[model samples]
Target: MADQITGGCKCGKVRYAGTPLDAAPFRCHCRDCQQLTGSGHTEMMPLAREGFAISETCRIYEMQGGSGQSTYSGFCPDCGAQLIRRSARMGDRVYVHAGSLDDPAQYAPERSIYSDAAQPWDAGSIIKAD
Candidate 1:
């Protein structure tokens, strides 16, 4: 991953730039992730919240996370494209959707989260943590 990460919504209504908190990204297979992404999982890259900057305010959706804390999903109101995810349990970082990155191909998930929640058809996609 690049030292400086940048990305935006489909309509370019929402944009963000930040320093990566970790080089190893992860795939989330929680039901909320599947529903939010309309897929089997969501690939996420972590960014330092202190270094993160957003061009515009995003529409936030709040839900209870697996940790029993509040989780927030940030997206473009205009394009309805999901861009970020943050949780009360992990306040120091924000997780950016890999697909929202300017260079999606650069995203390579190193591990799978919520692996037990993976759908049968997508079970093989999970990457066990090293």
Candidate 2:
């Protein structure tokens, strides 16, 4: 396992490092994710609150999630690159945008959620059960 995983925003204004890369990622196909990513889905990897470190301040946006808990999104203020997400529904779990990783090829979504909200044209066989 990698000692730590590192990445940054498109503009390199916001950088982050998550230690002990032990978490599996998942794909979110919800409408909000699609809108945020401008794609069919977004890949997310969860890290402990302390496991992640940031280099600079990021702009945050919050909204009430489906679970009635506030979800916070952190992004680069300069280039508007989305970086992380944290939700009240998922206590202590700070989710990082997999796409922000320096090498996203090292990770893949273990499963997909909110498939019902997936766009009809968004079809793929990426998920594998284990």
Clashing pairs counted in every model: 0, 0
Model 2 spans > 4 angstroms off: 20-23, 125-130
Top-scoring candidate (TM-score): 1
Go through the candidates in order and give each one's C-alpha lDDT. 0.91, 0.80
Query: How many clashes would you count in candidate 1?
Result: 0
TM-score for candidate 1: 0.93
Stretches off by above 4 angstroms in model 1 are: none
TM-score for candidate 2: 0.89
Q: Write the per-residue lDDT of candidate 2 for residues 13-85, one digit (tens) a residue.
A: 8999886345678888888888877889888977777767887578889988888889988899899888888
RMSD of candidate 1 to true structure, Å:
1.3
Cα lDDT of model 1 by residue, 7-118, tens digit: 9999988999988885479999999999998999999999999979987568899999889999999999988899999999999999999999998887889999899999
lDDT at 43, model 2: 88
